[model samples]
Target: MARYAILVRGINVGTAKRVAMADLRAVLEESGFSAVRTHLNSGNAVGTGNDGLDPAEAGARVEEALAARTGVSARTLVLTAGQLRTIAAGLPYAAEMAAVEKAGSRMMAHVLFADPDPALLAEHDLTAIDPGNVQLGERVVYQWCPNGLLESPDVSGWITKNLHVEVTTRNWNTIAKLADLL
Candidate 1:
């Protein structure tokens, strides 16, 4: 069996999507995922499943269950434990550690659902994303928002808008916690 981290977007933010972590865990467990658990109330979940469980399929199943059982529809992304560890490990070793240390919650990662188009990625550059602030990795993009999330380049939003891709973001602290949960 392999462990997977499920990220549900746009939930528990403001008064709109308010999905309880316990409810999400219950739904995931009922959907056939084993060892299901939730980290924060912010839509992060971890669970164990068969080796053949597809991430996209798991995401869809979680979405369907959330909609049918909880009445909240949101985008979900799944990553293998190894993938999550890789993303966590990819940090701290890079030359951008200074920004990371200083940014705190500003150090954000845009976890993507799939490999975006190369041409689309190269066609435009986000001006607000500093050189050291942007580090693209396998199915993920890490950026430091020194002035906070509001002042950042909105890399995830830009990708979804231009590349037509779906993405969810997490702060460095949240990423570390999710990695630990896996």
Candidate 2:
């Protein structure tokens, strides 16, 4: 069996896209995943699935099941336990970045579900903004907002709004919890 981390975008935020964590776990279990567990209320889950199924394929199955069983439609990204570990390990100066935490939102992982356009670099160069504040991984953009997500000089929204990539940002705290879950 392969353990996978499922990241769902835009759920249980505000009044729309509401998906209860309990329902999410049920949905994944019904979708043929076992050992299903959810972290937090923001649509993050981990489950054990067939080793032969690829992460993307497993994600698609869960996405369909969530909509069919739970009636919640959202972009979902799945990463293997190993891939998740790699992502968590790739954060440059992770401890220092995490230390800047304020309101539990200072550090974040901008998980990219699609390939970002090359032109994105021209719009915002995160590296130039702060020393060791941001590190762009193949699947994620690790950012440390020294002044908090809101006052970090536009470090928060630029990547999430990238026109070419469907990116979802998760707090470093959430990432750490998810790592432990897997």
Candidate 3:
């Protein structure tokens, strides 16, 4: 059995797209996942499954089960525990650590469901993204929002608008916690 971290996007944010973590855990467990656990109310789950499902297949199962259980359409990204640890360790903040220390910026990361297109970054006018505030990873993008994500609407919006891919973001602190959970 392999342990996986499942991230559900755009849920439990407001009145719409609400998905209780308990319900999600139950659905996943019922679908053959073992040791299912949830973190917070944002739909982060860690579980061990013996179904031999790949990340993509696990994500599809989670989405299908979620809709069947709660009638909410959610985009789920499934990553092995190792993948989550790699993403946590490979955060692109070392080069900007000093700058962030001086500016007290808040670091954030957006893990994309699919590999981003090579030309997507260049295709989107990135003048709005502050220098050293954005870095692209193997399958995730890191952004250092100096004034928090809520304060940087353009940068947040540009991620989904230009990438044309499903993504779920977590603050650096939360990313570390999730990695530790794995």
lDDT of each: 0.82, 0.78, 0.78
Off by over 4 Å in 1: 92-102, 126-129
Looking at candidate 2, the ten consecutive residues that score lowest on lDDT are 95-104
Candidate 2 stretches with Cα past 4 Å from truth are 98-104, 115-132, 153-157, 160-163
Candidate 2 versus the native: TM-score? 0.84
Judged by whole-model lDDT over C-alpha atoms, candidate 1 comes out at 0.82
Question: Model 1: how far is 179 from its true place, Å?
Answer: 1.0
The local lDDT score (0 to 100) that residue 76 gets in candidate 2 is 81
Q: Each model's number of backbone clashes? A: 0, 0, 0
- The candidate with the higher lDDT, 1 or 3, is 1
> How much is the lDDT of residue 33 in candidate 2?
82
Which candidate should be chosen as best, given lDDT against the real structure?
A: 1
What are the TM-scores, per candidate, against the unseen true structure?
0.90, 0.84, 0.85
Clashing pairs in 2: none
Question: How well is each residue in 1-182 modelled by candidate 3, as lDDT tens digits?
Answer: 88888888888987889888889998788666888888889888888976467889878888899999999998888988888988888876766655665432377778888886769867875445666567777677788776776666555467778878777887776677778777
lDDT for 6 (candidate 1): 87
Q: Write the per-residue lDDT of candidate 1 for residues 29-112, one digit (tens) a residue.
A: 876689988877889888999898888988899899999999999988888998899888877324554535555487788888
Compose the digit string of candidate 2's lDDT tens values, residues 78-138. Answer: 8889878987878776567545535346777888776567777667665765567777887
